[model samples]
Target: MRGPARASYRPVTQRLEVTFLPGLGEIVADEIVERLAPARPPRPVPGREDALLVDHAGRLERALSLRTAVAVFLVLTFDVPRPKSLTSGEHLPRIADAMATSVRLGAARTFRFEAAGHDSSVFQRLAAELAHATGLVHDDAEGEVVVRFRRTPRNAPQPGATRAPTDQAGWDVLVRLGGRPLSARPWRVADFPGAVNATIAAAIVRLVGTQADDRVANLMCGSGTLLIERLLAGPAATAVGVDIDPDAVRATQENLVAAGCAGRATVTRADVTAAGGSWRDAGPFDLVLADPPWGALHGSHVTNPALHADLLRVAHEVGAPGAHLVVLTHEIKVMERCIREADAHWRVRAELRVFAKGHHPRIYVLEHV
Candidate 1:
């Protein structure tokens, strides 16, 4: 006689909402699969591709380590007809539990609601209830934990749908785990006028693929974003950044020490476009990263094409045969012209266009031939 099969009991899977820049959802998903290796690879939320729903169990400390994520939230779904129902129903305890988990895992002390129309009385009422239930102060100004409520987008209307005209479901309560957004790099002590986002920089490094013994170089390294991200991504044989601006050089130097990237990289005040600079002969680099000004902020458009041409010459001089050059820029026409002009020396390999807020920046991977 065979014994009856025992039913295996599994705990509830914690759903994490990992948000990033709009165009980077796919990259962020791949990173989660590589780093976290969750039970199932993360899937993008419907109608909100910028955010992914990650199913992870138990503690959430490891999930917060994702460099490409802007913020990680512990999501809880509540079935209430109206927003006001949450203030009276069984949702308070559940929210308190989520808050406890967030505080425990993230070591947070305060909480705040990050929602549109947050100044409305409904949000204020909900905030008051959460403070009472969680025993945590609700500090709107400097709160460490951010709680957000979003409606789950459904294709079809539910049997008892009562809200808006479009199909809608219950509220998804998202409690952010950390004191600050992950995009705010701790090592960024200095700021550049048009500095690229840290998460985008991380994505660039990931897409380029790092090697242990690769020699890395950054031209026009404003605020050292690409250099620091590369050093953090993996072990490099040697890394160096050069900029004509003394302030940029100083900022990079400051960030190098702050980021614990001192032994891995060096920063110098030298013109990358000039053939006579000391940094010109220090190359034969395996990887070259560039984030040049796009005429809008730092450099003007009138001379940008010539400047980009000079940049190509400098990279060609220092790059090893078949070396890869990864470039991020918004000056599309100028870069297109320069790449065409330098066709004999370089060839385009891959290109990815990503959105950062309202700005559209294109990333190009080129091979020095």
Candidate 2:
């Protein structure tokens, strides 16, 4: 009986405490949690109060303290569904205090706060209050704070501080569309090129796992957005974009050239529904990405259902087995139906609900099985 086969256990070493602001979607909050605790299981009970234990790589406990520990507080504020004011300042400080207490208990010495919302004044006040409470001087030079909240039990002086990424870079560059300069504003309700579009584009690049040299296509490539992003990412193997709008095709070409990727990418004027004949010329592509118009949004008078059906038919015909197909649209039911009708042994690897400009844009990633 070899001593029960010597059970092996990995140490539960890294721990992080996170607080979610009211009105932020649970899904987005959960993603933030996952980034911190990649291996921790989901909370077992609903509405239970406990510090979240996240396992980031490395020895994190020694790094904990008021002046020296590395920790961040993320606050997201939005309108509370309906019957609530479109904006409010009532809960901003309360949320900030809640997060501060969490980090204090965790023995984190240094603190950085990030507030995302429509109101800038509320966040500024909250930051001032947090700095005052901790006795940490706000270091405008580095855009963070260093303060000794309390001496540890061992009388060990807390370590010095380092800045959080958000404090430095502001926010992650989630997506780039059609060579537009980066923006920090939220997406609008009536149009595209909002946060939702940026997020979906970033997700596609992340989930599809494309190399710098993989040949990619944007079938029905309106404005050549998807193709432009791919080129910005790297010198892809090759990129071919197609669209029925000659204006859109021309714009795509111009954007690619301006981005210095015209040589690696090309745009042609062709309707995707009739893509079979033309797309064959650009065969053996590694990926196909598109954001077909959700009905009249792309300036077409066609109904959403009809457009969805046509896009799916074209995708099935053009996509090779195992090729990645990434689509972003607002027509949830119609897109689902299109995937079903394809019947080409495809599997949906991921789906995301993006809030842009006021409409919920859903993104679907289908891989041919």
Candidate 3:
């Protein structure tokens, strides 16, 4: 006689509530729904108003309730990249004014202004002006302040790079501004790297919502910046990142190890265009997130319109039905056509314009409808 057979520990899906930050609303919701749909088993709908009842794996549950859930919960902070034409004196006031307007327009609740590529005195002056305009008490040591407004509740302000000191935890995403300077590139063009702009990145992440146990994958993973940030923003299903560039793969691997997420995340070199190639050998994934190369930036060498189409086709083939495909692209016509031609049903969930230098980059939230 033997003891009872050891129980196999299968993962179970749980009900989750998702709130997209201010600008991300329906686009993020649609993306989240699409990503989770294939993994969900068909189940009878539950009676609910303003709530999306979804079948998670084998479990029936409500994932998001517009009425009950706080729709926009996350706030983003960004440091302005120094402009090529501006001197220290001119730059500080311009950034300070921008920050004030950003807060006034409700883009952020609070912000930490930092001086990059210049002396600390510039940042101090900007901070002082921000303090005066917003009626925020300044903390010189931490380089932050609190904004006072009628709508802001007593416990609203939280201390951090992005939020007021009183803001609650569990922010779906957070972004730090300032771009990495590329080697062999001039300072002006090197300001913005492939990593999405900080504010825009946070907005997109909030749009995607958060899942405690959702399996997520990033194809064409660049520096693994998004993956690293996602790991830090916890309660994910699981994460896997792949890049065609071996150097990017190596960097991602090193970053994961350094961030203590090597156990939960993996990075590998895999060409997305290869036929029948699959990341499933890694594990079943729930979400496919990517910032595919923009044709405009890479020109004809790396990413072109044809390559975009091929990538979308491959993404559809590898992705589970109803999985959300969130992508950032500057070429609108190219992406629109690619999605139209792909096998998976795709709908534009959200769109945003990211200004870099003089160009405006478009971020698209595509859903596998």
Off by over 4 Å in 2: 1-181, 184-196, 275-279, 299-302
Error of 2 at 127 (Å): 16
155-197 in candidate 3: lDDT tens per residue? 4333344654453222111112111111111111212236544
* Quality of model 1 by C-alpha lDDT: 0.86
Best model number under TM-score: 1
Give the CA lDDT, 0 to 100, for residue 127 in model 3: 50
Native RMSD of candidate 2 (Å): 14.5
Model 1, which residues run further than 4 Å from truth? 1-12, 105-108, 156-166
User: Residue by residue across 1-369, what tens digits does model 2's lDDT show?
Assistant: 456676787764433333222222333235444344455543311122221223444343322311111133222223343212212355334434444544444424344432234135644454466566555444433332222111111122234535322212111101111111122112221222211243345445655665875878887776565676666655687689887878677766776666566788778887777635555577666688888776444634357778777776666666677777888887788788878877665679888665544677776888867
Q: What TM-score fits each model?
A: 0.91, 0.51, 0.49
lDDT of each residue in 185-301, candidate 1, tens digit only: 999998888888999999999988999989899999999999999999889988989998998889888888999998878788987886577675667899999999888779888
Taken over the whole model, the C-alpha lDDT of each candidate is 0.86, 0.51, 0.51
User: In lDDT terms, how accurate is model 2?
Assistant: 0.51
Model 2 compared with the native: what TM-score? 0.51
